[model samples]
Target: MTTATRVPADPWPAPRASGPVRAVVRVPGSKSGTNRALILAAAADGVSRLRGALRSRDTLLMAGALRTLGVGVDTEPSPGATGADWVVRGGLGHGDGGPVAVDCGNAGTVARFTPALAALTRADTRFDGDPQMRERPLTPLLDALRQLGAVIDGDAMPFTIHGKGRVPGGSVTVDASGSSQLISGLLLAAPGYDRGVEVSHVGGRLPSGPYLDMTVTDLRAAGATVEATPASTGRPPVWRVAPGPLRAHDRAIEPDLNSAAPFLAAAVATGGEVLIPDWPEVTTQPGRMLPALLEQMGAHAERTPAGMRVRAGDGLHGLDADLGDVGEAAPVLTALAVLADSPSRLRGIAHLRLHETDRLAALADQLGRLGADITVTEDGLAIRPAPLRGARLDPLADHRLAMTYAVVGLAVPGVTVDDIATTGKTVPEFPAMWAAMLAGPHLASDNTG
Candidate 1:
């Protein structure tokens, strides 16, 4: 496989071994929440204003997709609005029955969700994306949509979506091993169908299953009826949603706990403490495991009313754990494991290989570049802590890998990450955020623990 060769201008920060890195940082809006809110707002009846919305590439792509489907999305200053909020004037369905092509970039959410919404319209629209996105599978979602009477152009990425304008939703089986996006897509668009969609799983286990809950919760909040059945071996879990008009409710997007993991992990690896303000106490994000996992590694992780506090221990221990649910945070966690006192084995992450890049291999290759002892397997990674002699790191066109390795740079000297701009896919102000956190006082000496 080809690797990213371009070196980043503002590469890894200088390694600091004995200082406390303590600062209270406010995380950006959740990418998952923003995408769902935007889509739900687009399907709502009246104007829906979303606050603290993430203005990243993925959400921006979703916004652009909404506009193509006749939704009026205004980002400019609106009368009596606080902060940089987006005012989405809803009630605009797909118009003119014309062919509209959407370039979702590398956003799988956009690629999956937009097609289902597009199928709800009578418009003959084609959904396309970058080469990587085109390579990603959408056959499961397409098959389910086809079962609902929506005409799809073969089993391809740049396929045409000949919308039936009215979907005859019924029961269909989908393989969610590839992605949970397939399930989320069907759930989001199923509400508007004449006979709401009922989906069942076919093969392999579902990864990131909690994300599907987020989708259902968001849909229910938007006034859609959805019920999920228990999962059984060899039988797909069933989901039933009733056809109805979505309610126009003012919703607050949750803070991204997953996005906050790398910073917390950075604190654990570098003998510092980082505070993330406004982290939700009740969140389904699998990345919430960071605090517990860090504690297991001999760090102190405390959750206060304000937010979360993470402090590094004298010595960190390696952990053998299965992270199938919160697999998105695996790369950074594995990077942090490289600083532990022993070897760490992270299993049940095979789903990660299907993301924007082959995450498992990408993490292994990049960490190996930094002199880390990493072994990439079909299931997951086995990482042994070593004195990571910083080397030029390649981000493999993956945003998570780029951002995760940047955290590795805080504690390792000479670590450089290429294609840093790829972080715009999720966190827009990455290097800036790192710089801000680094300017704070070190937490190792501050015995506030």
Candidate 2:
């Protein structure tokens, strides 16, 4: 995700806590999941309803993008409604629709991933976005699009796709080590192409492997044939998607477990308890590693029928591990590290520089403001728990950064989060939800039923 950012006028002063924190949070749908569902539903053989879909900036932008391309999208509750349902009349494969313009709006899913889908249409489509999007990694996916027979005007953001109403997709190889969206964006729309697609990763470590797995899992469930040579099998990765009719059906989107990080971490940081409902026993989401992460941080975790319940231990211990697979949780992890009783080291997350913000650098700067003993590492960070003091902090418009600091505010005092509204990117009602989770007032919760 990329955008030209500015300091918001009203910076939010994160609430200081008086005691142990307890709250039950039902996070909205996964931005990743909702966008993927919208894409799949758009190409399906019939109308599909997405229940429990996350309606936020990213997903809404995706829906808006699909709509501009002539996909029928209707929200049961309302547009941009959190925990909302969607009815989409699709089966309108690309290129047949009229010309369209897409505003990527700092969403990586929309920025790097949609060009391949756009190429499948015989429409004059233009893709444009904010300033930061121009600097994001998109060439890998765009180049792959060109090889697959789509006429593209530029190598990166602000490009145009001249859709032929049909793609002669066959085989394309790309090194998606920097970003998995390159591979996923191509594969998601591959089934619409005449010959389908065979995508092979050239080499090296693929950041966020679990996310790619999630994409593949959902793709298969939608009736597309997907075959892959696992990276763990000592071979380069490759995905073969068969051209076919996508099965349209109603599916309940899962809770955004990644967004559950901060609320869950508040438990670990404050020696309190927090429960995130509807935690899937089996999931491809990398956030599934949270329980393990909680244990490593010296927290007690219980898996019950309701959801995952976590409580802090007598003290937090440091950890040394690679977090590349679960990069989205890095901010929350860093916040915990700053308050741990011992030193901690997190490695294998350098790729975070390419995220919505330069996460690693942003974390370093923000944590520094909070007075943490943080040392920036080339691939990750090292921290020695210190007496953190509250201070005004800017997340640079990064939602993860904003939430991470809010977790810190639970244990510290007078911490403020600038541009807190930026959290609307994924969780629209985050501030309200967090406020509800606090002790004095009320707990803001969403009931899926």
Candidate 3:
């Protein structure tokens, strides 16, 4: 079993920080990239090897879903704390057995992407997820499938895809303002459509362009032709994926820069230094916005030979910025904003409500308990520099929320985060990494543990 350091069965008393952070932390592979690669690989025609794929609950759940679709995904147990490598024999065609069934487990990617692949087969494929996923939006993607001539029953999760073993893939438009998953879901499985796929958005604005960029980059690398209209052109974004067979190839996943936010935020909050090595010099990961965003907020960040390094400035400052393109960093930025000398206003992430949880509401409610004067707005949240007191924080079973609250505990006392186990969703090594960061390794373990 490739479990992460054997976590406790009960809620972890989150490790607290005593002083400025000084450590070299290695984050795992990108879940976004891994899940996308898995879908594309499953749709391909040959064997593919994916090295450095994240082995967390989310990515594993994606692998399981692909397995249900009759794709062969073989993973080697991770050795020495690194991510596992996957040997996937690609043949998305139906096996000699019965039809498929996928359990999304609240993973937005699986719930959204797999149905598109199922539409390529004439089998009766069932798609469902946890109760919360049933609440999130999947109608946009489902509507697009219906437009492409796939007979789908039900609007969201707990639905069935009655594929006629052929999709008359062509032009289809859907409003993806709620989440970019809808856009990506269509593009990934488009190659299998008999005529390929052409998707246009009919929404106010797309939420995460970088994520789609990652999708396009991966798709084109796998030999699929993709054309995307510039969103700045005033017309809604349009994507054209030509009909072709995806060429299976080897992929080396990059470290999840988004998951690295909190650990790097440790240095920013305490005027210390932290190094995250293997940082990609050029990549589509949205966390690439860090070098500039942190710099704008009173920190010196640069790409070093070791990795991305950040040194705390004279002190953390505040800035008003629109985080529409890179919304995942909002929670990490909000935690730092509460400690800034000046107030901070984070805008352009209204779609975050449709995430694993209502992030804006959860942030407002949980951070409020920490004595932060935070206001949850329709698009985002506004936080003022207020005297914060350590209070019981509820993670709402969201991994990002748990990681964000843990960073806030570095400056505040008596901050206890409920559902620390939820961090396993993306970063199962979170507890050990947090512990190592606080104790400074060669130091004592109980400093925060």
Candidate 4:
């Protein structure tokens, strides 16, 4: 049996203050959208191509899993060789091959989404992950699939997904206490089943609701019929997707506003100016609420067709907001609260505990080490903004925590984030991108020209 080990945090010392910092940055593509698009494209009938897909560990794992299922996947540089594009030939069927093992490499998205996609194939495939991935729960999704006649091994990582050829899709009530990915996975795999699939929530409150919307949107874009209904007494909210042959469509993934939130928070916390290009003005992404929250805290934010423009205020103030829909942004938002002049309270984040790490505890523990007043409640965090005394931060092996604390370091000198390499799992160019963005006046001057 392989035991799970915590990845040691690598400390990143506070960046040396250069002159006035300003830059227009093109944030990386959305990992969420890219993975969803990849899976949808893989399940579609014809060829679907994606431009500016995030080439991170998680997306790579999805691509590799698709390849194992016999999907023709290719990567080609755009005409100018500036950005990469993916060409995917979809239409998956049962392979006569033996059990295919997939290594998701700490990507909860790929780990959860793949099982449903794998069920579409007649082959027996096993989904496993790195130590961290194993620690994450797959029971909710597995239970839902099992209810639909898919044979899945319960209580194990690297569990076998026995495809019984075709699943009779019917109504399933999924307990989303663990992760919304459970619901998202079932919804993505629903279209390929024999009968239409109807998923309803069971017990726990659904966190990350926007992410589920992203799934529904992508599923519809791939020519699947999906209808979302409100929750009733006995039945949970129902998401119905009809079984059909999927058609291919070229998809351009939206910008990763979740990834961009930290940088935008850094700009607000440190009294700096930063612009994230290609950000969608209207987005279901919970991260889009940052601009309004930042403005509420006295930061200046303007929305342009190009993207979002953010400038820090004279001083930051505390805010109390319900973040159930956008739990992913909770860490960075919590980091922002650390620099506020007053105590900030963030609620409706109980689901944060089940992510890549126990984000609520991890955030409070690490931020407390920096001499900030933080408390992790059952539902969310309460933070008192004060001058954070620079200290070594333990990121607890979570990519979001590591990256979020790095933003904290921008305002508090001498702060360092440990286990920094884990950032590569989601944002590969983190250090270099941060360094280049923080190059201060050099980047600012270039952007001005």
* lDDT tens per residue, model 1, 1-449: 33334445765443444455776666787889888888888888888888777788998999998888778887744233222467787764546667887888889999988888888776788888877787776888888888888888979788888766677788888998989889988888887778898998878878888889888888888888889997876566889999888866666666677888878887887777888877788876666777888887889988887678988888778988888888888888887788788999998899888888888888887788888899987789999877778787778778888878877777777877767888888887877777777776444436655
**Candidates' C-alpha lDDT:** 0.80, 0.84, 0.86, 0.80
Model 4: how far is 370 from its true place, Å?
1.1
Clashing pairs in 3: 122-163, 122-165
Backbone clash count, each prediction separately: 5, 6, 2, 8
lDDT of 4 by residue, 1-449 (tens): 12255555446775743543466667777889888988888888889989877777777888898898778888877553223578999987655664788888778888888888777777788888887678787887888888887888755587988765678878888888678888899888888888868888877788888888889988888889999987777767879999997888997767788888877877787777778888886666767877888887778998887679888788888889898988878888888888788888999998777777788888887788888898988799999865568888877667899888888877778888777876776787788878877864333435565
- Assess the local accuracy of residue 255 in candidate 3 as a C-alpha lDDT between 0 and 100: 94
Q: Whole-model lDDT for model 2 versus the true structure?
A: 0.84
Candidate that beats the other on lDDT, 2 or 4, i.e. the better one: 2
lDDT of 3 at 228: 89
Q: Model 2: per-residue lDDT, tens digit, 183-292? A: 99998998888899999898557899999999999999899999988855656788999898899988888888899998899888887778888999898888999889
lDDT per residue as tens, model 3, 283-359: 99999997689999999998987789887899888868899999999999999999899989999999988888889
* lDDT for position 174 in model 3: 89
**Regions of model 4 farther than 4 Å from truth:** 1-10, 16-20, 79-83, 232-235, 440-449
Which residue runs of candidate 3 sit more than 4 Å off their true CA positions? 1-11, 77-81, 96-99, 232-234, 441-449
* Residue 105 CA displacement from its true place in model 4, Å: 1.8
Task: Candidate 2: give the clashing pairs.
Answer: 94-121, 95-121, 95-122, 122-165, 436-443, 436-444
